[model samples]
Target chain A: MIHLYQNNGYNIVLDVNSGSVHVVDKAAYDVIGALEEQNEFHTPDTLKSPETAAYLKERLGQEYAEEDLTDILEAAAELAGQGRLFTRDVYGDFIDEVKQRKTVVKALCLHIAHDCNLACKYCFAEEGEYHGRRALMSYEVGKKALDFLIANSGKRRNLEVDFFGGEPLMNWQVVKDLVAYGREQEKLHGKHFRFTLTTNGVLLNDEVQEFVNKEMDNVVLSLDGRKEVNDRMRPFRSGKGSYELIVPKFQKLAESRNQQKYYIRGTFTRNNLDFSNDVLHFAELGFKQISIEPVVGEDTDPYAIRREDLPRIFEEYDKLAKIMVDREKSGRGFTFFHFMIDLEGGPCVAKRLSGCGSGTEYLAVTPWGDLYPCHQFVGQEEFLMGNVEEGLTRPDIGDAFRGCSVYSKEGCKKCFARFYCSGGCMANSYKFHHSINDTYEVSCEMERKRVECAIMIKAALADA
Target chain B: MKHIKTLNTQTLNNTVKKGGCGECQTSCQSACKTSCTVGNQTCENRK
Candidate 1:
């Protein structure tokens, strides 16, 4: 599939399947469009149209001679033949492979604790306990989860487990024991275990911080920018802001982890339209890796990013891009997680089509040992696959998630940014639209603007 | 496979220019927008 868009006055054509981007002239662009429109309605033998050529010449102000137009059309046909322009049915082989592949659980998000210290207004987990009874994962359940991952991982050598929560740190003992247990199992099972911890930092004392810094493969510290913004959105049940409590601890943890993988993750709401400043604040605070995501929830909420906020949000992204470029120029570059695209070496077409591998390759284990596709689907019993002991009782749910992809989604198939976005968040889709295949339109638009900004950044940096 | 899309010379010229390819070594899974803590590392092998 080919996607066409205008960027910085250049007509850019993205060959989605082949990952090739081209910049063409107005005459070539018009000719390619005309040829594609004709190819859609006619066979290759009758694809060349004298009438369409004449119309394009007139419509494009006759920039190219009749002979030149013919040459351009021929070149476009050659590109199509080479499977770069207007390609169709490119995922047939991929679909076949997916059909035959066995489902394995390679990653597990263990809900270490069901209780959280903070009651963020937009908490998807009903303030971290998943809106059910509060509990912590038992050592037995945690060990069983490890066993489940190891047994079901097939021939995969690297397996991953995340300590997730209302706040994982609340159940710190179980988390520590599980890491040690995973290491013991690694030696016995001949596999490598990658452990990641996501925390709100309210309970991050020196010892907890030290332990995570040493043991966790990746640490995701949750902080939503400045004090006021964070306090307003993410406060304790007592209505107290958490920014003051977590900032110094987060700073120390970030400084201590010399070469380890970590990210200061924040969320932007409608209140902060200029969220770029929040990112800048993190950079100034010496965070080398930062991620500021838009808050996701019901649209009716006053703080949710409404359709009207998109124009300002786009401008904020542009502003952030400018600041990011400036930082690079000054030799003080930091990685903004969202803006960092693998342009030279992105994921394969198959991986892009399949998305984050939530169900087939990954699962989230609740404190009670119940399993779901991912954290977003944890409390929703209908999505429950099974418990660790029972081992995927609802295999059909897994199959359904496995079958989902950008190719299967009607809206995503036509988007130029489909490869990068991977059909958006499935949980968000199910939450807002009641279907995993449907996308959240607001997030879709936001993602497209981000892609445009990313392209602009790439072009500017390449020129420089 | 090589095709040239038209360039808006005026817009291209007026565009602010920057330098360097700011690629990070982290895995795409880690950088995903979703709240899922785990990331996909298959692309790391290709890199």
Candidate 2:
């Protein structure tokens, strides 16, 4: 059972199980609550301002000055005591850490092999453009990059390492060497190490599959739905249809041991924009999780899928979620990373003790050992944090990320989705906006609508 | 105090800039034309 209430004209939804309350506008509160609660709704304790203040003081600790602490605690307590977790407690914390910034990327995707056998239309790395320049990252370069990550991550708990390229498997030897080295370092440092690689399935054979299952924690297979849809966008270097080969490999991967180990990621383009039925095919192929991304490239027509096609995307997502839900109901369990919020039913981005740390906690190092904001702008010049020789410690990486105007765009600061979307993708900001500070408007709106759809579906499912 | 205020203003301006909408012409719902709680209110309110 759950409870609903209103404080300061904001509707608060509380889950009795977790004591989690999501705050929203009074209108949203009424609409969602009325629609969701089939049974009677109850109102729980409304902690008064005085009690709330006392709680805040305790939470903030006793070292603070009495005068300032009293005022701060009063405001914080008022919100937390109410169920407006999103609006009050979340926004309160967001506002308080006004000067603090957190890091999102702990490691970087150093493109060890840019040489790929397949030609995927939506490949981020321009296949023909950087072909000759695509040299394999040597063991020496990999060592330096690993050392940097280990040293920085030593201060933290988990460090992430992702491999990228035209296809990361082209330099499988390097990957094997690095994974071995990373395992050694992980043992020495006592830190959590997670590895992921996104690949077109042309090179993923039985041996490769076993290695990825054992060595790499996650592998993102690029398969865009049905054979026809996949073959059209993802073909061989010689322009031959590679769907038959990929399907077998995908099946081998997803069904490997069990469906719990791998995820299938699809890229939608103008060619197959309305392929919702493809989700069924994905489910049949034994993939437990899937991520659908729109093809983003320069000179690519934006409306490949008509603006109205947004509903179709949601329809497909809901359908897929239903299938997974039914599967779970039947005692088969599957988890999807793309639906992290839905599965966990918690905050979208975890808050830090400090403020939003973009460049500090998370730093991206390129194949060339140049540190950047994240993996998205690996080779982009303007987003460079610093080079590897000096290390990011002495440099302005922390300061730049901490003070980078990216977090404070007028729209972002004011937008309700600020906590969830985080001013859109930083990569899109640098690429399309040409400034790190620019907000990704289209993506932001799309994500908000997507979140709304997810919330509605989840609420409906919970009721059923 | 003067230096701190100037730095705060600069930080505020920088925040506003990095977070401003990318100049997109799409009739996207995310244009964020709707006014929010703290718009152009300066660092004082933000603090």
Candidate 3:
């Protein structure tokens, strides 16, 4: 499938299946669009047909010289002939291979502290209880979690453990213990452990930063933009804003570590629809890597992103793309996570087809040692796949997620951003439709725009 | 009127101008709470 669009003064064409990208002039873009209008799939005979050539000239006769039109047609046809444009879905053959592969666990999002110190309004973890009692994973459970990862990882050498929580600092000691244990076990198991931590920064201090710099591979610090915006949704239990308390900590951590090694991730709701400024706001505070996720909640929730917000949100993304280009050119650029896409040498087809490998190669472990498909599905009892002790008692649940793919999702099947987004978020799908194969419209729309913006930024930077 | 530049696997333009290690542990699983958008951003790359 080919997607054509104009963004930031560049007319871009993406051959989705083959991962080939082309920047074409208006006339060439129109020629390709015409061919798509005639036939969705391009076969060799259909490309070289005299009837097709006559049809192209007849359809676009006034727009260009017949010779130029003919030349473009030949070029497009040759590109298609070489499997670079209008390519058929050759990925269908690999679907079975993706399903049949003996996938091993490579990463675990370990919910170290199921309890949280602060109350965030838009938090999906329900302030870290996850619909259960507030708790922290014991060192025993954390050790077994790492051991389980090393055991189930098969031949994979790089194993990941993310210390995620309502606040990992709430259970700081166990986190340190697990890291130490993970390090000790790595050489023996022939595995390398990459530990990460995600926190709200209320508990961040000099000691934590020192330990993090030494042991953590990446750290995710959450803050929801400006003072008022952040305080409104994410307040302390005593009803205080966290912005003033955490900003300095976040800044110090980013400055201490390689700036690119950490992400200052925030969430934008209807309250902060102009999130581009929020992104710029982060840049102002000296963050070089930022991710502001959309706050998706029930329609009844005040902050839930509605369909009407899309146009404004889309414009914001367009505006941000230009700003990013300017910033990069000025040598003060930051990496916006969503706008990051690799056009070349992207993830393997197996990864593109099956995303993140959740419920399969990547799993989430709860504080009490229960397993789920991912952190988003932490409290979801239905997703329980067993614990580190028994190891995958409900393998069927993981198998179900393994079956999901861009081809499997109704919305993602025809999406040009399918390979990039990898079927949206499974937890989101389950929430909207009660099935993983199904996905929601809002996320799909957001993802497609990000892909376009990412491509535009790439093109604009190339031009600049 | 003809302005087209075609790039395949080998000639694909990178979105980020700077090139370094793209692999990061758990980055994929973090993005969507399941996948990383451009790959991992682990600090080991810094090392």
Candidate 4:
């Protein structure tokens, strides 16, 4: 038997026997309440003061507060505890149990190649002299990494083998082998296999496109809007324009049967910051979903676009979303929003509050098998988590990361958007500031502004 | 007789020790979900 309680706006259920507590939803509470009511002698007929009135008020005002449902569910928890449905141990162990249930990354990044056919100017990987010393990962490392992921199968529910690099398919053989190996492992473990690749579409051919269609779960392609802008930003290693080469490949891949699995990614630069028209032009390309990210530069660099330009960007982005949404509604196949705000209401697997969990939930393994917090810190020593061979069994790495607060950054604690921002990306903070320890004020400011846009979008579509 | 049963249980307990969730520590993706900043300028251009 389980009893429920509402504490601190959380719905908590207490186990009658071991006193172990579980958090339950509204339906679960209602079922228990009905059961208790059926056994007339087990529960009192007279209604409680807090639960009854609170439920009435919350149910009546459900339209006013989006979170009112949570409040009502918690009331059931309060009732369960008052009825002595559980012992003290149930409540005490609940937090620890929840921590135990958290998801862990079972696999690591396998960088198939570090050499790109087309070089983008704003790419962090190709910035400065580091571009010349690119390397490709061997099949040997891919096998070892896959084996390691398969062996450590205790904690993770879904095993994701992501191919990232200068461009993953630059060496397609290794990717093929890894995918085959991952499938075998999936058969053995009985857990689902998820694969994703981020690439510059230059090297993607018919065979590669077919393999991606059949195997990969998500594919993110790089496109920098119109021809002139793309040519200016992304060129060949010989400094020739790559827009012609990339656009044809994009067309080929889009025409492929696997086009539905792809999403468009564009990087905004200072040159293109004023070109909201360019964004609309990119949307006109017929890709169902797209993501636009601003370029990062030195504080003094003229290339860096400030967060103030978001309103215009938001307008362009919203237009694109509307087009895509309309297309889907009109039975022109399916298109998804890159920012799935509705799906991310609760705990989302794709994102964390501050940023993607670079240090913990995800690890970026370089071509040399050196482990870093993420791909963004490939050359940087500060973000190294552990080596692929030695594994994540060390104490110091976890301790250092734990001490680095996602929420408790000095400035973040006071920021209004702390819950949503989570101190931004720690790796970005370290690389630009030359310190692992710093406040994420700029990212938070950008997020608050974005939220303002979201509010406007909600209001505009409230009646629709 | 009760003393004998307690001693028997103690001897059996020596073969196995109590353990927590798993040898792998901290399965929580709470840290990751919390870490994402919405407007990643790098990805912002992709739109």
**lDDT for each residue of candidate 4 in A1-464, tens digit (9 for 90 to 100):** 44444432334443333222334445444544453444322322222344543544454443434344334434444543444332222222232332334435554666668888876777777732233367888877777777666655565556666787778877889889888878887788776667877777878788888898889876777777888888888888788887777767776676574456566667667778645455556556665555555666656666565566656665655554455444445555333223333211222211223234455556667776767666666677655666668776544553444345443457654443433344566666775676555654555554554433333233223323
lDDT of 3 by residue, A1-464 (tens): 89999998889998887778888888899988998888989766787899888889899988989888888888888888777788877676767767767778889999999889899998888988989999989999999999899999887788888999878999999999889999999989888888889999999999999999999888888998888889999999899999999999999999999795788989999999999999999999999989898986988999999999999999999999999999999999999999987665455555566666788888899988999988888888889999999999998987898888877777877889887777777778888888888878888898889989988888878777
How many pairs of residues collide in each model?
9, 13, 2, 41
Candidate 4's interface RMSD, please?
A: 17.8
TM-score of each: 0.86, 0.69, 0.94, 0.66
Q: Tens digit of lDDT per residue, candidate 1, span A173-208? A: 999999999999999989988888888998888899
Q: Model 2, residue A141: displacement in angstroms?
A: 0.5
Ordered from best to worst TM-score, the candidate numbers read: 3, 1, 2, 4
Model 4: CA > 4 A from native: A1-103, A127-132, A255-259, A307-338, A343-345, A348-355, A393-395, A403-406, A414-416, A437-440, B1-47
* Cα-based lDDT at residue A306, candidate 1: 89
* Position A352, candidate 2: lDDT: 15
CA lDDT, every model vs. true structure: 0.74, 0.52, 0.82, 0.52
Pick the TM-score winner: 3
- lDDT of candidate 3 at residue A43, scale 0 to 100: 68
Model-by-model DockQ, in order: 0.10, 0.02, 0.21, 0.06
DockQ of 4: 0.06
Query: Candidates 1 and 3: which is better by DockQ?
Result: 3
